[model samples]
Target: MKSELDDQLCRKYPTLYRDRHGDPKSTAMCWGFDCGNGWFPVIDVLSELLSKHNAEVYASQVKKQFGSLHFYYSGRDKYTDGLVSSAQSLSSMLCEICGSQALIQTKYTGWFTTRCKEHTKDYSDKEYVELDVSKVAYLGFGKAWSALVLILIDSCDWRTEHNGMPATHLSITKEAGKLIVSHSGGDDFTYTIRSLHARFQ
Candidate 1:
């Protein structure tokens, strides 16, 4: 009778196995014949594997949920004037043209001036127009200058409108203090630093 019952049970669950030496032991090992402690019922083993997979899925969902919550609660507002003001403060301390210690003075509208005497000798009398260094077709400026130039060109509409204007180019001529923009039109408009600000405003 017991042998018939065991055969029927094994047939019902192909993956299930039993040790029938004297005492009966049930197991769900992948290898149907191996009746070791490691063997578990098929459904129980599959449930554990599925549980581990589900844990990973749940973890990822939680991470995305937290990320979205952070964006809604804090990230958006933290980037307001506080961040801009901090960046501007840092910009004032560093030179935007060259990566040197900028001469912080009342001139240049309290912004950090990048034109050293060597660079500004030619345009000493003329106002030094601050052009976006990124658009100027030159490299070798440090990271800060590159970032500043990128921001000015991207954010400032005036700079964007005049970026690729024909006959417009920045030059460091012998007579210029810093780099000045020479626009070749009817009057050969030479934009000095101060004049550039006026035009933008």
Candidate 2:
């Protein structure tokens, strides 16, 4: 998937494959895609905008947090913010997990994510699935995005949490010999939580 994505990015936006001094390279040097595959279209849009202007842009950060997608870049000037804002707006309507048309933001285990009605799960009204936190499992770890998220697979209907409030505080600790991860906008391990928090701060 990484190779395929790289190839596609290069072919679609060759300017991303350039060196710092504006020399085109065989591989993209400074670009990054830190979000899920669902936001590929948003990335494509941003890439196109950068390429169209020969802007020498470098994508340094991209992620989904607080139930929305975040696309940040280095080497940006006045023209880039507009493109980033547009992409982010589109991401709110699109599911972060599957790119479906999302009508609501869902929360699971104190973490928030945007999902379509079918994929959303309501843990309070329905039975809470016993999450096996004994073993270390990445709740929202991906090569692309570094967002604080709680993912529930094959669950009941989802209930909203935080009422669209942006996540502002996060913490994690040990409880009953299990990792108790929490995030803001809702509900983390200390080092892991701190590192993730640093990304936002």
Candidate 3:
């Protein structure tokens, strides 16, 4: 997926993706969603369903493997498991390039992909799938586009823990000409805006 959609999803559904930028050792999500743009709807629908579910479920990794959708996750009930299974099955009949109808058979060229007629010829044995950007909007990430950024800023952070914290009543006195930043929560690990970006990014 384009980095825009990827970032949008990670930021929109913070709880579902808190680990997306975390240490790879702690989460396969750090690799991010590894699939084509066509599967956006499938992922979108599934994410909506999973998010509404009462459990604190999360996906560890989402990718395409062997001409099929592979959504590996942890913390699921019987219904959520069924939802994942159904999404995987649905991918079998849809083009991985355009999300249109296609013959997703059990096999294809030695290196295979499930593609519609328009995209089948574009497949190659030497290359991994890299899809073009499509027009589909990942607006399903949230309902309100206007408030999404503000909502995300407060609700999501690269580190779910206190990114920059001190205490409720914090102190920030410039030692010399340099500036300082602190919160009431605790002393901030990063003292400058640029440093915070560097540390988080």
Candidate 4:
């Protein structure tokens, strides 16, 4: 779901708004919901181009992938192509998270994100102990989550047994976006943990 500020931006660029099924207002869902408000300018330009050509434009998809916006449109013409090019150029200067003016693109912990100074600082500095699962931890947490946990462990250079045995003295920490496995050590790896279950499922 998009924030209220983003919903206002969506209303301003209705042409860029579409449900996951590519239907018009069929749902309150948004494909670019994860995208920051920076895309607003790009969509605004696209909307203007659509109006100029009197073309009916529909976004088949709109989302950020691989650190860039993947704005799939059904209509293609000189104007639309130009709009895409302009958007590409503009995206480099806009934060991928909040749409603020960005000064840098970072991959500090393996996940690439373009962000302004504020978001960049937040993302770069954000760190915490995500989990401390026991060997008997429930799998109801699901395979996807297990995969992520394993990845994070690998990133932090933490040793793990295939049996999912919880380390008696395992320590998980985050520093400079990379998960660190020890209370003190140089060993570390870069992996992003997208979601953490609040309770054992």
Candidate 5:
């Protein structure tokens, strides 16, 4: 997820992310959200419930795996288990890019991701508002996450007010905005992506 959104969750549920400020060797959170921003709502809801139930539970990890959400935790309870399970199931049907309904769940480029059909295409003839985010992909983790960010951005257009149910489609309205997402530590980015020449670290 984007650092801006990630920050909100952490700040809202400090205890749920108690390990976030700990040594990197001790917590995966120091790497920030190790997944895309599409599932922020899922995490947010889960965090809220967990925090409400027990302010001492720690989320060991919240990431994607096998094209679905995987919310690891320290506290064990039927409610927590049920919540995590539901989020995972919901993730399979929601686009990992925009939180809209997904068409399919499959492995892309050897990585598991759920995407809407529009996010998996290449459109060069279109033009829209562009935010040149040559920086921002890297959320200060390192080379590994930088590469992950590149993959996620290929289909991450956050606008949810467009035409399609997913709000983005292979044949979009000529007036619709554009998007480009990239990675580099200490910052985040989104653009009406022209194209990204990924140079992974």
Candidate 6:
């Protein structure tokens, strides 16, 4: 009976190759259905199976490298229109802080980042300091762009837990009652000139 069913499927979708393992009874074991070649139901089943394995492998790799994996069920193949729509949604969501269209979707990784040429140069300048307020502002904005940087600076060096703490790689410059902070690490945090003096005092 199973052989009859397999024969019918093979006849219906001529492109689907038999499973290399020679298991005619196992529909799940079949392969060789190139994109757009297989019947819709067969394609759906194959896509689900492939995606499940791929997701597991990708999640494990991400966890090993980044210490965490933030996977969400996106209901779309990475190469499909669904993925493109999701990317656009994400870009819109971050528009307030990074500005609309500022986030660039990485082609290789499909990840999004707000770091652009101007921002990159700004961060590079943070590593060195001259007396320029504009340079200091550039660094400060970089820090403001990332909350992690603020937490590190506020908790580690600027707070009382460690006194005479070596100044953060970040340095502050005051001009016309505005504070511009720059870091060699490519971050900038700025505050009102008065607020900075008050915090230190």
lDDT for position 177 in model 2:
40
Candidate 1 lDDT over residue span 1-201, tens digit each: 133433543454332222222232321222222211111222122223223323221101000111011001111222222222223332333333342323223343332233433445543454544433556346455544444444333333343366442333333222332322243421112222213222221
Q: Which one wins by lDDT: 4 or 6?
A: 4
The reply for model 5, stretches above 4 Å from the true place, is: 122-201
What shift in Å separates residue 22 of candidate 6 from its native position after superposition? Answer: 43
Q: Candidate 2 — worst ten consecutive residues by lDDT sum?
A: 150-159
Off by over 4 Å in 1: 1-76, 104-113, 125-201
lDDT for 12 in candidate 2 is 77
Error of 2 at 179 (Å): 49
Candidate 2 lDDT, 74-135, residue by residue in tens: 66654465455545655665666576656335354666565655556652233323323322
Q: Write the per-residue lDDT of candidate 3 for residues 31-146, one digit (tens) a residue.
A: 98888777777777677667776447777888888777888878776556656655665565567888765545333357546666667665543433332212112222221221
In model 4, which runs have C-alpha deviations exceeding 4 angstroms? 1-6, 9-32, 125-201
**C-alpha lDDT of candidate 6 relative to the true structure:** 0.30
Q: In terms of lDDT, which candidate is stronger, 1 or 6? A: 6
Summarize candidate 4's per-residue lDDT along 93-168 as a digit string, tens digits.
Answer: 5576666555345466767655666666656544422223443144334333443344344423433343333343
Give Cα-based local distance difference scores for all models: 0.29, 0.47, 0.56, 0.47, 0.56, 0.30
Model 5, residue 159: displacement in angstroms? 36
Steric collisions counted per model:
11, 12, 9, 2, 15, 5
lDDT of 4: 0.47
Q: Could you report the Cα RMSD, in angstroms, for every candidate shown?
A: 30.1, 16.3, 17.5, 18.0, 15.9, 21.1
TM-score of each: 0.20, 0.48, 0.57, 0.47, 0.58, 0.16
Worst 10 residues of 6 by lDDT: 59-68
